[model samples]
Target: MSKIESIFKSCLEPKEVYKGGKNIPASNKKLYKLSSNENPLGASPKAVAAIKKAAENIDLYPDQTDIRLREALVQDFDGQLAADQFICGNSGSELIDMLLRAFINENDEVIYSNPCFLPYSVFSRWYGAKLIDIPLTNPNYHLDTEGILNAITDKTKIIFLTSPNNPTGTYIPRSVLDDFLSRIPKNVIVVFDEVYRHFADAEDYITALPYVKAGHNIIAINSFSKTYGLAGQRIGYCYTTSTIANYIRQIHKPFLLPITSIEAAIGALNDKGFVEETVKTVKEGRAYLSSEFDKLGITYWPTQGNFFIVDPPLPEIEFANKLMEQGIMVRPVSQFGAPGKVRITVGNQEANHALIQALEKIKPD
Candidate 1:
């Protein structure tokens, strides 16, 4: 065996790299991608302008502190959260890794919903931490609060909760969250990811940011990607207690997000009008897709997120391939442990129509 291979034989097991919805490479066909849950409206106009303006200064490094982004976030929170409580990262995924690095010790336990966020398991195992995955409750595919509570042990260090959880598109209600938080063990910290918050329209859906302000042992991470249409910019921030924020700051890479990204985020924040329009478009698209699924007799969970998990009328892979053949792209969720299921991101009016048309053609009668 080679020296490097021998040295790392027992380390870093092989795992499938995450592949969100992507465009097919052929230059000829017109493609409508509803695979990745990217904002179909694209980036905010103001943000695009800001990036153009900042392009001239690409040679210089960004402000490592990210004071402007943090300050904007604080104002956006309406004074409920202070700037000191924020920790910016390349994306919410990076923040997850930082948490694993800063907190998880050998054999330490981490808990999260099964088939929720894939990276939670990946990062936990990378840190040599024990991962306890609790399956979502049936019928709604919501968080299994009791199962999570029961699974907790002395070694448990973190519990990851993704609001309007990915793939499943279900969210934990406020009452459930309150109960879960009250009973959570003192040794554990809950990491709440609210990347899709803006798309959630359910009345009972509550953000965990308030808990952070109340000084709970929770960190709420949000991104400009979904709501602000800045996914390509790779900007996300978290709200936590000052103590945890300090630790995250220590571990967060220096100048992690570039100046251009920060400027774009700042501009996105300024364009509240654009944010509202994007949310409205997504809400309408979600309704349209859900109604179409119902008419087609596809079994799908009600979603507060901008995506839907549907049991396609055919085998998952075959169904996804059919969609791709029609020049439409979507996610097959078998890798997320849900065989025979696929997740579709709500796109713009035209893309939504294209997706529905594609499904109608392929779905078994």
Candidate 2:
């Protein structure tokens, strides 16, 4: 008899594409961590202060309901969403798992694209849901909405969409999203993971909130990890219809969000200046990196998020290894199902300069 669950053999662990400079030695040259798509400026100063104060009350359990943070989101959305319609989790990743646990039935199907977030397939299989993967549109790497619409079956329970898609840094346009939604059966839940939304400045990009308000089975998951630079604190939330939110909240365990994490998220939400500055830095850094890539004759996708997928002259792993030897951390996209491309996160000026220098030095002859 098998000792563990029979399903364990079919489930694959998520690939660690980025390790946040863990590979660098202590005595090595100062590491310029540009692997994970994090805010180069670090967490908001106000968030740091709030976390320091909240640390004093470590003995107290967090309010699992996440009332304050939900209210903050509602206010941020200009009251279009209610507190009851928002649910907070340790991270957007946790929320993904919760949605699958609360809604996906055995053998039900979940559809997403290749080169998308790793957690979607991981959690879907963990819950015994069948996964259907669609390829991104060629050259642009946008979600193939027509392919997705064609893939849906009566057994399909969830459709996972990632805007500013990880590794590719591309997004589905508003027209595509609208048309796709119009065709999908209302019974299927659509989850738009927009953790990188704040950094997106694409002209045709639109959020899924309108569909949510119109009573569509849509949920938008966002995180403090990207925009607010609170990745280490692990706070993220989702916006959806109240009924769905209630279901997710019920599935959520009590006190999943720690006191310090919530406090830091709340402070980050309220800090407008810090957010604006972070956005500015990312926008500028993205442009600078793109230009540098051009000067070095490297091809890269035009990104709407804080990272780019560059095609270096050498294999991605080979290029990434060269950079790592120079104390630079970057992510290779082989495990993300996009071989020959390396994902480069935009960093502050010094880090960017270091990366550019490394790339130029290692340019294939």
Candidate 3:
């Protein structure tokens, strides 16, 4: 065997990488991509302008402290959080890895949801942590906090809770969250993923940032990609206690963030008008899609996020294939453990209308 292979035969790394939605290439016609849940209105004008301006300074390294981005984030929250409480990453996925690196040890137990954020399982196992996946209740797919609490043991180290959870598009209500937090064991750290926060419109929807401000052992992950339409620039961050933030800082090399990316994020935060418009656009698209689905007799869970899951009239593969044939793209949810259904992102008026037309054509006779 090769030296590297022999030295790491027992490593927890998987041979296959994550497989999710993608934008299909080589179509002769125009494509309305509803695959990845990217911002439909496009990147914020301010962020785009920032990227252009910062591109001139590409030779310089990023500010290791990321003070500007963190400061903007603090102001974004109306100064409820200190800049020290923030830790930046290439994306929220990296923050998850940082948590695993800082805390998870071999045989240490980690709890997350089934149909969970796909990365939760990958990162947990990569750190040699024991997996305790709690299944969200069927149909609605809401978090079963009691089931999660019941699964806790002395070995448990982390629990990931994705509000406005992807693929499923549901959230833990405020009452449920309050009760769960009160009963959570002191030893277990909670990872609250909220990258889709800006798109959530349900009345009961709330951010877990308040808990972080109160010094709870929670890390709330969010991103510029979803809200500001800078997905290609790749910026993400989290809110946590200052102590945890410092530990992450120790293990993380801050210079890895690109200078252009930092400037773009800061610019995005300044454009409150753009964020408001993006939210308004997504809200309208989601309502249009939901109404169309109802008319077509489709079965779908009510969603608080920018996307929703749909049980199409045809088989998963066949249905997805048909959609593609009509110059549209969507993701199959079988990989998320929600087989026989597909997750669709809310698009702009033009894209949403195209998708409904395609669905209407593919509907059963």
Clash totals for all candidate models: 0, 0, 0
Residues 1-365 of candidate 3 have per-residue lDDT tens digits of: 78887766253655424675785698578998898999999999999999999999998877877788889999998998899999888888888898899999889999988786788887778888888989899878989988999999999999999889988999988889888888988767999999998888778787888787777888899888888998898889998999878877888775868998899999999999999999999999888989999998989988888888988889989999899999889898877768898888898999999999999999997
How much is 184 displaced in model 3, in angstroms? 1.3
Clashes of 2: 0
Please list the C-alpha lDDT of all candidates, in the order they appear. Answer: 0.86, 0.86, 0.87
Alpha carbon lDDT at 104, candidate 3: 90
Q: Which residue pairs clash within candidate 1?
A: none
RMSD over all Cα atoms, model 2: 2.2
Q: Which pairs of residues collide in model 2?
A: none
Ranking by TM-score: 3, 1, 2
TM-score of each: 0.96, 0.95, 0.97
Off by over 4 Å in 1: 9-11
Global CA lDDT of candidate 3, please? 0.87
**Clash pairs (backbone) in predicted model 3:** none
Best by lDDT: 3
lDDT of 1 by residue, 131-212 (tens): 7989887767878899999999999999999888988988889999999999998769999988999988888899988788
